[model samples]
Target: MRALVAAAIGLAAAFALILAVTAVGAPSGETSPEPLLTTVPGPKK
Candidate 1:
């Protein structure tokens, strides 16, 4: 039981470290995400 608890705690800590690293290392995006461009043919301009 003690070993199981330790293992669970270790796994949780590992996941937390991974989350932090990924969050820090991820590419930062613009404050505003890029807007999508749409194209529509006007009624024969």
Candidate 2:
């Protein structure tokens, strides 16, 4: 019973850590790159 509880706690902590890392490491997009230019033509100048 004690081992099971410990394992559950450890799993929860690991899950939380993964979420925190993902949140922190994720790009906030404030410095996002500009869109690529395509070969398609647009309206005449």
| Residue range 2-45, candidate 1, lDDT tens digits | 99999999999999999999888968675667766597647774
What TM-score quantifies how close candidate 1 is to the native fold?
Answer: 0.55
> Model 2: runs farther than 4 Å from truth?
26-45
User: Which 10-residue window of candidate 2 scores lowest in summed lDDT?
Assistant: 27-36
lDDT, model 2: 0.89
Q: Write model 2 residue lDDT over 1-45, tens digit each, in one string.
A: 999999999999999999999888976567548876787868999
Candidate 1: regions farther than 4 A off: 26-45
Top-lDDT candidate index? 2
RMSD, one per candidate, in order: 5.8, 6.4
Cα distance off (Å), candidate 2, residue 43 = 59
